[model samples]
Target: MTKIADLRSQTVDQLSDELLKLKKEQFNLRFQAATGQMEKTHRVSEVRKDIARISTLLREKRAAS
Candidate 1:
């Protein structure tokens, strides 16, 4: 999980890259859940919230600029 302060310190490009990685992770988690091979079901929600947090931060940055 990424902290908001850590995210706030990143440049837009860095945040974008992190967002893409998180999205890929989310997809893999969903796939794992579908295959019944997932052990950490809680990670799904954590990834989701992280995605939202990054997205929100991105929006704020854009708006501020």
Candidate 2:
């Protein structure tokens, strides 16, 4: 797994793609949980944190411009 700093180093486009992917994964996790098929359910929280981290970095990067 990539570190938050490493993720921050990426370009906006890359970060956007990753953010989208994370959201999709989060959706799937919710579905799995609802169906009682989720393994490692704690992962959902981690994904949320990652999304927030990425978004915060993105905002910082933009504001620095």
On lDDT, the leading prediction is: 1
Query: Model 1 over residues 4-58: C-alpha lDDT tens digits?
Result: 9999999999999999999999999999999999999999999999999999999
Best model number under TM-score: 1
Q: Write the per-residue lDDT of candidate 2 for residues 1-65, one digit (tens) a residue.
A: 44987996799889989999999999999999999999998899999999999888889888898
**Residue 41 miss distance in model 1 (angstroms):** 0.8
Query: Model-by-model lDDT, in order?
Result: 0.95, 0.89
Clash count in backbone of candidate 2:
0
Q: State every prediction's TM-score relative to the real structure.
A: 0.97, 0.90
Model 2 residue 7 CA deviation (Å) reads 1.3
RMSD of 2: 1.2
Scanning candidate 2 in windows of ten residues, the lowest lDDT window is 1-10
